[model samples]
Target: MSNVTRYLCAAAYLDSGFRDKVLAELLFDQFRAIPPSYGGFDLMPVIYHCRRSRMMLVVRDALITGFFVIGCFMAPLSTFGWLWTLVPFALLTVDGIRRGPLIVRALIWFWACYSVFSLIFLAIMTALIPAAAYLFASGLPFSGLYGSGSTGSVLQQFLIPVVTLGIALVYRIAIYLTLVGSLKPGAPEPIIATTHPRLARRLDYIRRAQWGNVTMYANEDAFMGAGRIQRNWSIAVELDRVRESHKPSRRADPVDIDPVELHAFVRGRLIEMRDRVLRPNEGIQRLDIGDHVVTRGIFTVADGQRDRAAGAHPMIDRNGLPRFQATAEEIAAIARHPQGGVRYYQRVTINNAGQEIRDLDGNLVAPAEDQEALTSAFIYLAVEGRMLYTQFVVTVLPPAHDHYHVVDSLPTMTSGRVTWEALKVLKLQLLRDVLAAPVRVVRTAVESVRQSAMTPNPRDHIVYPYGARLSVRELGASESLQTHIQVLDVGKYIKMIEQRLTEAVLDFLEERKVETGAYRMQAAGITVSAGNGGTVNVPMAFGEHASATVNGLRPGT
Candidate 1:
């Protein structure tokens, strides 16, 4: 398995709920759109792994059931008939008892241990009491009850199986511990590919299909997981003609500049920042203009076609994938409109080295020296109601959690070591594989059935707001900046992007013959406040909720 796949699998193994969510939302929810993952991580391999694990559970269940049936039949003919019957029941009882509330499970385990101790105590006293009586008295007191064919004989018969079962249980536990110890990340890649090449190919196909699509759901903040908001401020300056004192009549004339043209100019300037970078690896990795549209939910084919005909087309392509771009006219219209549902943004993505890069097939494309981190700045420009509006929201996408990176440091095992470890675990694992099979079978079946039943044509039902709201990359990302360098980089990129954005807006205003006094003052204040680590709050004309403020410190600090 690739590093990315290993991290994903380790994540799944560590967190069952996250694993189930990935399967349910991404793999099983056929109708829901799968969101595009940013920060150079592929989510498809994780989906494939979860699916494969589920299948393995089914196979394990089948083997266990087969063994159980054979044991039941052999119980009548074998000398260890009682053992066969007791083993399965013992496994089931133990498995069932382990689950439920934590406190209850603990109490149950305590009671079981206490009961076993009591039985051992009684057995020792029965033998010792009879021996003492024989030594003290001529005829053994209670000899009939304690003799070989009576209590003593019964105790021996009972204790023999109990002791044997205890030893077997200990051996089984050792096997389990060995199996767990042998479980290093990336160990399952070869087995998965060797066992299921066709499934692996299918996953690749799915990954390619969904790679670029921006899966959106209601109320999903597209900016979420891009990292903490490092800077959020907007400037709206009135579009007033520069007063020519000698030719005052020109002031009455409206400023003649199209919002589309202005937006294009700003976008070009931002894109040019990439070309100006002196260091390729240290500079922006991605720079482009993208339209981010928030809608009620995904459109059905009929709804999509109708919207297309009506000229208010949905922001999805024919294949039902998000088209993160709109026509110039559409952008101008949305910008001019007072409501805030859609906007065009110039996104700058700066990827720091020391992060694993993987291909669509989960193959390693780039190796890492250290943890990977991404810093992105989104700049939105709009001209509305004879005022120029410019906004910047900078975010940091931190590296994946350290636990996920454990795969990179896994010990290298020689073929002999691998074989020996497997052999050591094989016997006990086989027993457990059969004994715990029923529980696995039932759990897997219930989950499979639940997912299948829940799958529905979203259009057929009344539209509910709730839908799959998950991003695997975001889910896997570390909660905060991993290192001091990441913090420094985030601040550096934010400043660079902000500087470019400020220059672009100023140049646009100057070319349009708009007065720049107010804009320059606001920009100066923002820059100074941000530099001094003071909060900079901008009054948003749109509404109170639209207003944003930035704390003085660098993001992820």
Candidate 2:
């Protein structure tokens, strides 16, 4: 077409299908090696034209009633012309790239190339079809027979289609060999760049292991969703790309994986995968579609550790290990022993209060005097390649801050049914403590009462017994002179325990406050001395009595 004609076509496109059709062609050119006639154009002008068209908001009506038809019905059309699939793919590829996964760039390229080629083949068929029809046209000299008497022979007619089909086969093979992970043996595979050091390491080994596939997700959610916080591990994978493509039967018999060992094995597999892609000698990898996955990604290092710490270790004697104190290596060792393949890991984020928490009730996490301590117990549940969950427990010990006592444990779960429900159980104990704390001691003629109860743990088979005893000190006495006791039990407690080694602290405060109040009141002309003893004096008749009582004061004064 002439330049003027083309410009006119472009201008009119805002109100027609020309714009979309042209853009589709341009996208095809960007991704495929098709000629310009097939939509190749410099990007600048194409981008400009696209912006203009979008602003106009000119909608073009499709030949079909629906604005979108996702090509499933195009199978019948395939017999007529395989080009239908290709055209839609080119358009879809352009749209997808403008707003979708660029990682699938190669797949789109494959689609564009194959579609363009299909179009070419169909065009050839269209041309030959006309010529063939002309020969067998009605009333032609050879119309009486299957073919009109033309220069072409019966062999030539059948031969043309076969040759075209063979060309199509070759086209498909060339694209696959060049674009897929088929690197010549001894040739190095081009490594995929990733920001994470761990990911990069995995990729290097994936290539070395000759696995043809490797995918990585830096954040928790991309193609998958883990969580939004760093509390969750970043995800990654290295596998045989060809095997993935073949849609091989899902992993038979779970492959035993020691998360630590797989952590190493993954590095090897990624290196091999990269090498095969970069350097294929008739293809560096010998992987086929039906082959099982010899490699996969790695996650949950901390989870495994946490699980073992929460008493999930298989071999170690349950009684021997310290509560929630197992180290990472110890946990990793348990899974590695005896060759029963299992792999998982766990991480922790500890927030410790200044002093050991004997008890807590919101603002203050107090210091326990002796055997009490405080801590957050986190558990990670990771099994095989899936099912991830996290559990949390806060432990409170004594004021010495030396050792952690299992005073309270609370459990929480994330992702799925978690193995760390033990955390929740601890919280329940704490709640019970606060609800019934300070077992009341009252002055009674009868002997003091002592009470105790036993608590049981589901994850641990230990019985927690709490004891409380009340006794009265004898001195002298009026009915009111003896001590009075009040019982306390605070439940739903956040946890706080305070200790003060002093006598009648509140009574002392009351006497001091009354003396101060009397001094202030007298300076304004009111009664007796500003206080020598625990009592404040007052005058009688005009104001008040001149006698005073000690250690007793009304709260309002």
Question: What are the models' TM-scores?
Answer: 0.65, 0.15
The C-alpha stretches of model 1 lying farther than 4 A from their native spots are 1-6, 61-109, 115-215, 241-254, 277-313, 316-341, 354-370, 411-440, 462-468, 527-557
Query: Which lDDT value does model 1 have at 24?
Result: 68
> Scored by CA lDDT, what does every candidate get?
0.56, 0.27
Off by over 4 Å in 2: 1-258, 261-330, 333-344, 348-439, 442-557
RMSD to native for every prediction? 9.5, 37.7
Give the number of the best model, judged by lDDT: 1
Per-model clash counts, in order, read 2, 77
Q: Write the per-residue lDDT of candidate 2 for residues 299-369, one digit (tens) a residue.
A: 22212343456524332223321121234565555334423333222211111212243333545456522
